[model samples]
Target chain A: MTEGEFKIIFTGPMGAGKTTAITALSDQECVSTDVVNTDLEQCDKALTTAALDYGHIDIPGASGVRLYGTPGQERFRFMWPILASNAAGVIVLLNGQHPDLDEHLSTFVDAFWEGGRMPMVIGVGRLSDDDFFTIDAITEALVERNINPPVLSVDVRRKDDVLLLVEALLCQIEVNELGLAEA
Target chain B: MKQQRLGFVGLGDDTASACLSMLKIMDGRSGISWSLSDPDAADVLMVANESTDETRRWEHTSKPRIVVYHHNEPKPSASHVLQHPFRVMQLLSVLEDVASLLAPTQSQTPLKTDLPPSSIQAGAEAADVGEFWDSLHELLYGDFPAAAHWYVAQSDEGELWLDARSRRFMADPLLLKRMMHHNIRPGVLRACNAPATEGAVACSLFAMSWMITPHLPAGLSSWISADSAFQLLRWPSFGSLAKSRSDLTLCALLTKKALTRDQVLSLSQAAEDDTDRFINACAMSGLMRYDKADLQTLPGVSAEAAGSRFGGLIKGLRSRLGLSA
Candidate 1:
């Protein structure tokens, strides 16, 4: 029997729009494990996805895909690998306004990078025209680790934008499978 | 699990059952994973020893084969085989051997200078923009003292001011679009000491360089030396730029490891000009490094992950979303 169901992960620091991205693509409303914010130092949001975000897309004729978003807090680090295991790929979203933009990028990239075995695409939200070039730093950082995946500027509110990340993830997987049919 | 398709030919239903059972028994422990498939679609074939018809039917195929022999029958292939009543380790051993054969392409292989490079296939004829663009390219990619701070590109339509240090430039969006669409009249770019100090579309240095690629001449780009091996320093954003299929494949391959121009041609399903254009885009965008550094990309999918479930799943997801792979 085919393992028809697949998982794609959306993860990043708090308020990076994991839920918003999922909601953009999900067939139904995303199920979130929300908690009143206690850690205001990390983010100023009223609520946070403390456990995970769950959503699904119904494939036309096959068992669909499951989308999981890891909690943004470092306290939930243990869940990252568990969620990543057997995932098709990951989308690491980042808050471009955050002061520690580089740090969050480094942390999530290091955490889920999994030695580059995991295919990842990064989407940075709210990238202003003045700071458009900072995206290069994110791209270079991945290169420093000897990994280069697509780093796109995105707005999670746009369904097309979120889908671009998904499409890129699929491209990443197909590229990895390039020699499959070769003799 | 490293998945590859295993097909059976002329095995009795009982023997097929035994093989599948043994495969399941070895699951998690078997370094190479197998899913049952028809012989036509299989990556490697396991045939019954006495099945001459089946063996003859597959003789012409380049797909690797392993003969299943009874303890008494003579082996056809010297290396790959299956003893009757498959043992878990024995099946694992044969699969691992086949996996090794299908691997090594993805592993680290030093660049070879001996291999013959195909002649550059002619693409579109050189446009009038080559002279003007090439000079700007020289200044952009080359090291110069006056250009130490920056340079402003002067053209008939508008001025584009660029800062090499910041990877940013300022130009009118309509002018940039006209350039990208190849609608701008052919003209030379003149250097002005003072950068544009007025209203215009602020853009990444990559955007203008990438946008101007189509208007540039097509062939092996001079920037990527034919003799030296190179790889990407970073991937350019697929954002805001047109991405061809060739672009994606080249990005996927070069991002993993350094390759000579021909090496890239041999490995990718891209045309010579498309390859040149893709590399040129990377170079002008400051995403390509000339000298090859020791780069290692893991063989994420071993020996036809296309034959595996995960590979199928990825394609399926793309298909479901109405996106072509």
Candidate 2:
């Protein structure tokens, strides 16, 4: 990875609002691959990101900072590592209300875990105060895998929440750099 | 006695007026007299939940701060807190201790903004901390498991009903919150026969155990077996608990691989005592388990290489994005 060229990847399961989160950060409209949805059982959203979503933040002195959102379905699993490579970090967003949240958490977290080399932040959205899948409960699913990234309760509809995930990912990056330095 | 100047910050008008009235009522007291002043001018501060700005400004200062919150419980941080309409005696007791804390001293640290309320110290908490944890240890891990399945942790705030088998508890959210947000402990645990009652919030023992770490009596010393490796079994939900940013960072590092105490200390670059405290919190919370796996020989990237390469970029991103810790 070039010194100033670091991209942050935003990947999650279906209906987790990756495109919206990317759009929230990207100075321009987030470019996405939206197609008519046939997999209603997987996610009931009318449009699904079929390929990948693309966005960028203009960072000075470097090849711009790119934001990539990988397709949520298993078929596009190939895109995850492609986007993850040379990336500074990844943000794993999940629909807290999804019945398959535990599996989604395990699958995405396992894919991007990186043994802590790359920073990851987990944002669970659409959870109400009374939702059964509280942030702590979601964190427990990762416990079985022994991966301990920051798990935050967030709503991607708000730009601040998206920024929070970005901030958290930065914190993680700072920590990783610090850890590597100390090592 | 020198009158201590107290200040209020981010308080509701009604709450501020009530505090002034309460101060007037205590005018005749012989202990350290307090005079309310602007937060910046006061020797101590009575802060509402908007403690971030004030705390960041005074992070290195030796002033005592009591977070005073009304309505719902404030965010679960702050070492010293007093709920609104606090009883006169409670206020007096807290004032007396805080006054002692403000008295000239080097060995003691004033109430740290980062510590949990349970770890709150006013001058001399070390004396009671051992006894506190000893009773708690006996309650949770006593030799006789069959002796009691339920235990009640009674403190100045309220009781937490514990199921010893599950290492979980049920407690009034308000009451438990006071123990967490106010400068108080869950007190010691005593065996009880009744099950956790209907209304209290059910929580993992880690939720309870992690709060006592900053005040443990032996914090300056090491608890780790020099040669043994440490790895986190799970990350305590910091979002659900009282913790500082460093706590999150440490948890992230440990969950990645088993590291020796020295390695952790070196990597974290935290003071020995601080490192010990984090390890203690993880161990006490049962989040860290004995893992003897020597460092999984991940290619040793010199810490310098990684730091130097990404340092400026991170700084630029944080600055350009206006992100602050």
* Candidate 2 C-alpha error for residue B303, in Å: 5.0
Model 2 local distance difference test score: 0.67
Give the CAPRI rating of model 1. incorrect
Off by over 4 Å in 1: A60-62, A129-131, A178-183, B1-127, B141-150, B164-168, B177-182, B185-187, B223-230, B244-246, B260-268, B290-308
lDDT string for model 2 (A38-78, tens) is 89987888999988899988767766678999999988898
Give per-residue CA lDDT, model 1, range B1-325, as digits (tens): 5788988988877678767765654454334668899999999888777857877798667888888888777656746888775544456557756876887442224322221111111122222456545555655554431233344555667666664434466677777766666645333333333353444555766676677666667765665677656677667865556676567667767776677776677666578878887777778767776664322322233332234456556666666666655
Each candidate structure's TM-score, on Cα atoms with residue i matched to residue i, is: 0.65, 0.63
C-alpha root-mean-square deviation, each candidate: 25.0, 19.3
Candidate 2 Cα RMSD after full superposition onto the native fold (Å)? 19.3
Q: Using DockQ, give the best candidate's number.
A: 1
Cα deviation in Å at residue B144, candidate 1? 6.3
Q: Could you give the fnat of all candidates in order?
A: 0.30, 0.22
Compare the candidates by lDDT and give the number of the best one. 1
